[model samples]
Target: MSEERVGFFTDTSVCIGCKACEVACKEWNAIPEDGLSLTAMSYDNTQALGASTWRHVAFIEQPRPEGRTELPLAQGESTAQETPVGGDGELRWLMSSDVCKHCTHAACLDVCPTGSLFRTEFGTVVVQEDICNGCGYCVPACPYGVIEQRPHDGRAFKCTMCYDRLGAGREPACAKACPTESIQFGPLDELRERAALRVDQLHEAGVTDARLYGHDPDDGVGGDGAFFLLLDRPEVYGLPPDPVVTTRDLPAMWQHAGTAALSLLGGLAACFALTGRGRR
Candidate 1:
């Protein structure tokens, strides 16, 4: 293990809905373009992060409360009484560049029968294309719905956090191409401290809703290598509110199964002993 662990800190508040990260990822990784003609997803045609879509720029337009609804007024007064909106009332555009969480206890890595998915020195998870047998075990194991099989090739694929770039001491392609520095990459510990300061600053500036997601080391999946500073609830950005690793109970389940098997054998042995006594 490397002494230093690296990861991503995506400050979604600063994202400008620019798909530069998305394009750069595909270009640098040589990923195929998907759903070129699909029209179902508005603004974000790439949709959620998947096999080919490594970095998905999500555009969310939240409705601002109707400005100052007028109350009934007397005929002679001829004036509209303005209704005050609560402090929560606000309007803003939210843009987040979504990518693989690369969880510390990555379920995908846990479920890979061939060991194709493994953690790198930087603590980011990667999938070895050649080693993948396309058994599809990893697809359902991922809590974030990341890591999908390429239809044509039947091989699972996802963001490797640009492991190749990191090996060369360079930032991930998406982070490098970001014009707003929305995607910042560095040592994981340093990034967490930086993200905390950013959230505090936003709160001080009256952006009370700004909060960090997936930064807690003790979170469900032991925190994500790529965490985010989300302006709204995670689900609003198409992310799960509380994601838990699917295989967290495997050990307990196995223990119970083993105990049950022993109990059944003991019962069978007792029956055989009783029959032998009768025969004697």
Candidate 2:
């Protein structure tokens, strides 16, 4: 029997802009260094998830919400007042750790001719580096742009949801290292329930903009193994608002192509038969 599906539910509201998850992921996975040079744009050094960086913490500075004087505490258990607002419209920082969505209808798996990407018993998508043929098809097949081809070797890579750790009955390194429990990992069902409650709490606390993303099983990508709770629009955090599996239309496309090919062949055969009859 297959194991229960497991995944991550990241709450952006409680994220403190720390990159502990990123560091733990790199140390546990032995990912190569992406870059060390500071971008000077923000505290975000890695900038985004890539072949070398499995977990990325984004730092977004925006104007503080109007009439909001206190920041909601983690889990909405309490509120913290005296939030420091900077000059020029009183900015508030939005921090979120981004990773692969691990879509239920994974387009990367569909486009991977080499069978590099596969779904685990836990219903999480993983990539076998040895099996990857460097075809680069899966790179563009991903809707969220999570997967990337390494420039040095041209092999695609993305988050595996810590498949090895799951097999060993341990939580992922990132979740274990998260200080604020922003990155929660568990059975998909339980996580969904907990996320719903958390959203409700935030809404009751007057954070009306709190919302869930990638949690619906009926979504365009059939929901995601890794979902998020965001404080603002998905686009504000560099995520697509509505992501559909790229290969969703493949079956119909292939059927149409087959019909057109058969029609052309039949017409040519009729033309040849009429010519032969005329010659006779």
Candidate 3:
């Protein structure tokens, strides 16, 4: 029997930016530690996803309400805006956990020269590290810019959606560790149904900005296996507003190229025949 399609429904509205998902991911995957450096970009230290960093949580601090007090600065700190505060002003801090989409039409799988990227029985995407040649084709083919080459190993890597855990009938570590149930994992169809109801509930509660991203089967990437319910614009969480599969137009491009080449060859043959006749 075919395994049901399992995936993630990351509800950004409920995420607290605690980075528990990040920690759980690294622990389960045995990924290298990344606590060495501070980039001075908000509370975010692990900036983006890579081989070592499978799950990244983005922190976006929105300025307080208009005519609010100027944010106080530390004695020796930069004068830039401080952490968002809602006590005296209407401040909103947006936090989101980003992962590989495991797209329905996976561009990484299409561009993997070594056949390292493969689809799982659960309808997720995974990469075989030993089989990877590190060609880096999949890096650019991904519209979300999720895949990356490890510095030491030079092998492309991203979230596997915890294929191993799924096989054992367990949820991905990140989802299991989420304190707010923000990162929900289950059958894709069921999640979609549940997410819709959540959105409706939020709307009824006067949260007009609530919306779902990457859930449509007819979307550009044919929909993401791991989708999201966002309270703000996708860009607010460092997600592309519209992600399109990079390989969607390859067949049409090749067809046009072949037609042009055939036309050029026919013209060359005609010229050669005419020259031969004149010489005779």
Candidate 4:
């Protein structure tokens, strides 16, 4: 609306698996701390995004064979030929910080029975806690599985895209806290352009797998206020490959229902008319 406001441009390639963004978000937003128990699933303490954890850092470790054995070398036997060092064939770590997408056509906003969820002038979606009736309609409406109900309050919550900070003309705390600038925030259009250039740069650097996700304006949800640049498939990062807004089919569904209702009424009227004629 206002020259297309900016949003996040997370470069997963630069993320160092640091939970600083996660910690900062919790600290600044006064979010409750989730359990510290580790799932032994990589180094990620916070397994995923939830009511308490907004920013989740995913750590992925890939292993590659160091050598090519001609005759299936024994467990302890070293191959006579050295395979290679770190290169195209070598394994590397891929880290990404996941957060609410703030979709353009947010289904959560559409499905909210109350006006708890609404779009801001910045075109970001926000849930008004005071207005939320805790009906939980928004929880599943989100295609990205973002908004969730708090256990204690039963009220839905999610990242506000740091609306207060944006209002104060300050960048989101997570973006500011990122040491490597992995999370950059600005106007959505500008961020998209920047993300595209970053993808190109990564490709040129032989990181051919680097690509942008959720940045397409023509995408199912229109586009996302917060998008990402990833080094692997979205599902590898626990994100959906193709997220269609759940409410996209609502209009067609209603139209079909209306047609069916009309046809039924017309049939009833014809039956009544034929019966009346017989009575006459």
| lDDT against the true structure, each candidate | 0.85, 0.90, 0.85, 0.83
State the TM-score for model 2: 0.95
* Tens digits of lDDT, candidate 4, 1-280: 6635768888887788888999889988998888955779678898888778888888887753344212111123433344455546566667899999989889998899999999887888888999999999999999888888998879998988788988888889899999888899888788888888777765554456678999998998998889998867899888999999999999999999999999999999999999999999
Say what the RMSD of model 2 is: 1.9
Better of 2 and 3 by TM-score: 2
- Report lDDT (Cα) of residue 119, candidate 3: 91
**Deviation (Å) of 269 in candidate 2:** 1.3
lDDT comparison, 2 vs 3, better candidate: 2
Candidate 1 lDDT trough over 10 residues, lowest sum: 69-78
State the local distance difference test value for candidate 3: 0.85
lDDT tens readout by residue for model 3, 96-201:
8999999999999988888899998999999999999988899999999999998776898789888899989999999999998889999999999989987876
**Shift in Å, residue 270, candidate 1:** 1.2
Candidate order, lDDT descending: 2, 1, 3, 4
Give the 10-residue window scoring lowest on summed lDDT in candidate 3. Answer: 67-76
What TM-score goes with each of the models?
A: 0.89, 0.95, 0.89, 0.89
C-alpha lDDT (0 to 100) for residue 170 of candidate 4: 88
Please give the distance, in angstroms, between residue 203's alpha carbon in candidate 1 and its true position after superposition.
Answer: 0.5
Alpha-carbon RMSD to native, per candidate? 8.2, 1.9, 7.4, 7.4
Displacement of the residue 166 alpha carbon in candidate 3, Å? 1.2
Best by lDDT: 2
